[model samples]
Target: MRPEHLKVLIVDSDANVRELITGWLKADGFHAAAESSGEAAMRRLREEHTDCILAAINLPDMDILELLRQAKLLDPAIEVIMLTSNVADASTVQAMRLGAFDYIVPPLQRESVGLAALKFVKYRNLIDENANLKSGLEAYRKDGDILGRSPTFEQIRHLIADAAATDIPVLITGENGCGKERVARAIHAASSRCSLPMVMVSCSAIPEHRAERELFGSECGAPDGVPYPKRGRLEIAFGGTLFLDHVSALPARIQGELVQALQRQMFRRVGGTLELPVDCRIIAADSADLAALVRTGEFREDLYLLLGAVQIHIPPLRDRREDILLTAEYFLRRICAAMNKNIVDFSEPARQLMQQYHWPGNVRELENAVERAVVVTVSTYIQPMDLPPLQTDPATLPASLSLEELEKRHLLKVLPLMKWNIKKAAEVLGVERTTLYNKIRRYGITRPLRRPSGSVQVPQQ
Candidate 1:
C-alpha cells in the first residue's frame, strides 16, 4: 500500500519526537501530521481524514489511553498504535484495553510501524470492496424486482431467468415475507406472455365454498332454475400467468380440479356442461415443504410433481448478512423521501446495531425498522437511540457480544470525547490498566480484533 494514500496522525508532547517521527513518516511517502498535545491531536483528527494514529502514552493535561478512546469514537476504522518509552507491562496491557491496534516501546521500530500502517490501509480497502459489491447488487433490484448480490440470491435470479422463458408451472418455496410473490412477478414479467395480464390468487384467502366457483367460473343461468356461467381464475388467466400464492392451502378437491386444468387446459364451469379451454402459465408459492406434506398425505404426490416443475427457494435475510447494510441504507433513503425527512445517514452505532441484529422477519422487518427510525429520529442523522431496542433476551447474552457490547456500552461512549485513551476508561471505572485487564479478563470483554478474512467476529458469551 502507498503510504501517501494512508494518512497518519502523530500525537506527542515532545517536539523532537514529533519532528523526528513526522520527518521519517513523510520521507517514507506517508502523509503525516504532528500534534503536540492530546487537545491538539483531537482538533487535527476532526479537521483531517486519518487512516492511522501514532500516539504517545502520556501528553500534557491528557492521558494517552483517553486519547485513543476519543480517536476511536471519531472513526472506529482508524487504526491506533500506542508509543511509550517506559515499557511497563501494565501500559502494554492498558493500550490494548483502550483499543489500540498495537503497543510499541520507542525508540520506534520502523518495520513494525510500517507493517501496522499497511494493515490499516488493507482493512479500509476491504470495507470499500464490500460496499461496492452491495451497491452493484442493489442496482439490479429495480421497480418491484427482488435483487440480491449474495450467491444464493444470484442463483435465484438465474433460475428466474430460465423459468421465465417457459410456460411450465413453477413452485416457489420460502418463509413468509421472503418475497416469493416478487419472484413470481419477475418470472411473469420476463415470460413470452408479458403483454398479458398476470392474475394473482391466494388459495388460502378464498372461502372453501367459493373456491370451486373461483377456480372454475359459474355457468350462465336459464329462466328460473338455470345457473349462469362465470369464468374461473384458470379461465380468466388464459394467455397469461396464474400466480397461486399459498397453493398448499388449497382444499383437496380444488387440488384435484387444478391438476385436471393443468393436464387438459379445460374445465367446465359449475351448472354448465360446455368445457372451456384456456392456455396459461402456472406459478405456485408455498411456505411449507410440499414434499413433506405429500408424505404426510395432506398433499398429493402427483399434484406436487405437476406444480413443482421448477422450484425457486428464496433465502431468509439472516443468511444474507452482506446485503443487510445496503438494504438498510436503501430503506432509509426511501423512507426519508416519502416522509419528507432530511435524515442523511445513520450514526456508526446505529449502523452497527442494524448489522448485528438477527432480522427474523426478513426484509419486511428491516423495512419496518428503517421506517420507524426515520419517523422517530429528530436529527438529520439517525443515532442508536433513534432505533428500536433490539429484541435480545436479557438472560441470554449474544454469543459474539464481546467486541460489540464493549464498544457500544463503554469504549465508544468514553473515548473520542475524552481525547485520552487509558485515563478515560480508567477515570470512568476508577481503575488502572492492571485493574482494567483483571476486570476485562474477569468479564471476558473481547477487543475489536481483526481476522484474516477481514470480518469482525465478536466472541459470544
Candidate 2:
C-alpha cells in the first residue's frame, strides 16, 4: 500500500497516452514512468526494478505478447496490464493466456483504471508477502534454499522459520533424501550457537563398540593401551550444535547415556572417571517416524521426547509437485556450473518428463539426476533422453480401473504443466477439444481455471 514502494511502467506508442497515464498515476502518489515504445519500456525494466507494467497491446516495433512474455521472464512476480483499443475476444483471451494481469480497453477512465491498477498491485503485494513469509520460515526450519510460489511450500517454510528461533531440540521427520539435514543446518545457523562449530554424528556411521567413545571423550592411560585424551563430538560441539543423523539407529546403551547427559549436562569420559560439563544444543533427524518407532518399541520413548521438543515434518516431493521444476532448475544451474556445461534450460519434453515423475527419492534424487544429465547432455538444452526415466511402471496399474479413472489421473498430472489452460492441455495430450471436454466431464475434474490477476472462473461444462 505504500505508493513509493510500487513501481509502475507505462508503455505506449503514443507519447500523449503514455504521458496522460503517467501524470494521473503520479498525481495519485505512485512512482510511475512513461515510455513511448516497447524497447524503451523494456530498457527501463532492465535498468531498474518495477513492481508492475502497463503496456499498450500494439506497440510500434515489438509484439505486445512478446514484450509481456519478456517482462514476465525477467521477474515472474511482476504484474502486467495490457492496454489496447481492440478488446476483441481473441485478443483478450490471448493476452490473458500469456499471463497478463488484466486487459484494459483504451479511452481509459481515470477512476476505473486507477481502481483496477490498485487491485492488481494489491494482489501482487499479497503474493509477495506470502513468499517472504515462506522464505523466512525456510531459513528458520533450516530447509535448504526453498524455491517455489506454491501455498503449501510457503506455509512449510514459514513454520520452519518460526521453529528456528528457539534452542529447543528439534526433531525433523521425513523420508530419506527429503533434505532433513539441510533443515537441521538451517536451525543451527539461525540459533545463538551459530558462531560455534556444528558437529554431525551419524549413529549409523559409528561402530557400535566405539559409539560411546565417539560421543563422550576418553582419558589417557585408561585400559585401551594408554589412550591419549581425546574430545568426543559432544565436547567439540560445546556451546554449539550437535546434529544426530538417524538418531533411531543409536543403540539402547548410547541412548541412555545421551539422555543422562541431556539431564545432567555432564558425562564421564570413556575409560575415565572425570565428569565433563557440556553446553550444547541437540538437533536430531530421522527418515522414519520417531513416534511410530517409539510405539513399536524400536526406539526409546524418553529419548524421542527429549529430542523432539519441536518437530518438523517435510512432505515428500510428490506431495509438493509445484516445487519440483523450481528445484530442478536450481539443481540444473548448480550442476551445469560444476560440470562446466552450457545447459541453460530443459526442452519441453524434458520438462514434461520431470513434471510427470513422482520423485520417490525426493530432492536429492532430482539433484543427482540433474548432475548426471548435465554430464551427458551435449546441447545447451537438456532433453527427455538426456535424463533417466522415472520409476513409474505400467505393470503396477490396477486391473479393474475404468478408462475414465486413468484419464483423470493423467489429466491431473498434465494440468499443472499447462498452467491449467484447458486448450493447451488438450493440445499437449493430442486430443480434440470435444474429446477433452467429454473427458473432463467424465472425470469430474471441475476445478476452475485461475487467471493471472488471481481471479478464478469456472469453465463451461
Candidate 3:
C-alpha cells in the first residue's frame, strides 16, 4: 500500500519563508505544518504522520544534516526537501549524499519550489498507496476475502470507496461466496467509526423465535435471578457498523420493525418501554434477489428501499475471467506460505482449467481449490490433477448450479467464437433476437475484444 495523503513540515527560522511555502502547499491541496526549530520539527515527526519535510539547511538547534539524518531514522519513507539560499555550500552536497529528496534555492519562485514539493508529494502518495493496498490484501486474503487486481475489480474498489465515504445503509448484492462480508468489513474499516466494534448478525442462522431479542435485545428486571439487561447486536454495534448477513431471510415482522427503526433512527428492546437511539450504520448483504422478494411481498418494501439506497453488486467469478488465474496465484502464494510448501506455480493446463471452469462458489471456492491443490501436489508446479475434481458433465449440470450462471457461462463460451455477432449468437442459442437480447441485458454480459491464438477452451459447464 502506498501513501496518498501528504503532510509537509517547514523548519525555516524565517516566518516569511514558512508562510510562503505553507500557502503554496495549501493551494496544492496538501496539509502543511510549520516548526521554528529542528527540535520542534523532530517532535512533530514523532507524533504526526509527516510524509515530506522541508527543512532549511541552517537550523536553530542543529544543522540541516543532523535533522535530515534524524528524520530518515524516524521514517525512511519520509522525503526531505532542503530549502537553502546557497546551493554552492558544502553542507548542501553533504545533505544530498545523506538522502535529501531535493533542494530548493531562493529566488524561491513558487513555480520552481512549489513544483518540486508537488513532485515529492505525488511520489510519496504513490509509495504509500501501494504499501497500503498490499497490507490490506494480505489481511483480507487471510480470511479468504481476497480482492483481485483487475479492471472490473478496480471499479468495485471505486464503489467501495463511495460506500465507505457515507454512513447511510449499504446493501451488498452478490451470489454466495462473492466476499460480501469482506466488502462490509472494508467499508467499516474505512469509515470514521472504524475504532468501534462492527457487530454482525446472521439473519438466516438466527432462530425465527429469537430474531427480535437477538437484534433489539431484551428488557431488564427479569422475573427470576437475571440482574443485567442483555445487549442486542444493534446496541453493541452502536457508533460503528451492524452487518446483517443473509438479510433477505429476516421474517416480515422483523423486517417491518427494522424499517421503522431505520426511518426514525430509533429502536426499543423486546419488552422495553423506552425507545433507544439507533446510532450504528447498517450494512446488509444477501445472495437472494431482495427486490424480487419485495415484489412477492416476502420482504418489506420500505426496508428494502432503505437498505438498498446505496447498493453494490458483485458479479460471479466466471464473469471476471481475467482475474481468475491472477486471484489463483495470489492464493497459491498465501496458502504455500501458510502450509510452508515449496510449490512454485500452476501448469498451463491447470491455469486454463481454473480460468474456464464456472466458479459457482466464487472466491471461496477458488481459495479452497488452491488449498486442496497445495495439500495434494508433490511437485513444484501444480498440475491439473492437483485441483479438486469438478463435474464436467455438460449434458447433465449439477442441480446446485444456478440457471442464470449456467446460461451466462454458456454465452461467454459461445460469444467469443461467434465474434460477438448478435444474429449469429442468437441463432446458435436457438433463441429469438429479443429473447437473446433480454438475456444479455439481464446477465450484464459484455463482449471481449478478441481471444489469443492457440488457446483452447477448457471443458467445464
| Candidate with maximal lDDT | 3
Candidate 1 regions with alpha-carbon error over 4 angstroms: 1-144, 221-229, 393-461
Expressed as tens digits, the lDDT of each residue in 1-461 for candidate 2 is 56667889998888788888898888877899988888888899889999888888878888778887888898887878888777776766687887888867856879866986788767877887878866765555444565555787677667666766777788888876777777777767667777687899988767788888889977886436654788899999999999998788888999999999998889988887878887988989888788898999888899998998888887888788888898999888877787777877999889988887877567776776787689888888998888865545334679787866766777776666556777766545544355567777766666654556665443563
Task: Report how far off residue 267 is in candidate 2 (Å).
Answer: 1.5
Q: How well is each residue in 1-461 modelled by candidate 3, as lDDT tens digits?
A: 12226678889898998899888888877788899999999999999888888888998798999998899899988888888888879999998988888998888888987788767856766776878876875575343354676787788787777877889889998977677888898888777777687898889778788898889888775322256688889889989999998898788899989888889899998778789999998999998999999899898889988999899888888788888888889889989999999998999989988877876567777777788899999889999998866444344677887878888877776566456776665544544355567777778776543476544432211
Error of 2 at 56 (Å): 68
What C-alpha lDDT values do all the predictions have?
0.76, 0.78, 0.80
User: Please, what are the lDDT tens digits per residue for candidate 1 over residues 1-461?
Assistant: 55678888888888887898788788888899988988988888898888888888878867877887788899988888778777566766787876778766655767766676667777778878878755643443343356567888878888888898889899999866667888988888777886687899988768788888888877666212445556789888899999998888899988998888778878888777898886889999987899999999999787899999999988877788887888788888888888888988989988888877766556766776677788888899988887756544323665666754743455343433334355444444332344445555555545554567655322322
Candidate 2 root-mean-square deviation in Å: 24.7
Clashes of 1: 28
Each candidate's number of clashing pairs is 28, 6, 15
Ranking by lDDT: 3, 2, 1
Task: Please list the Cα RMSD from the true structure of every candidate, rounded to 1 decimal place.
Answer: 29.4, 24.7, 18.1
Q: How far does residue 71 in candidate 3 sit from its true spot (Å)?
A: 15
Scored against the true structure, residue 105 in model 3 reaches a CA lDDT of 87
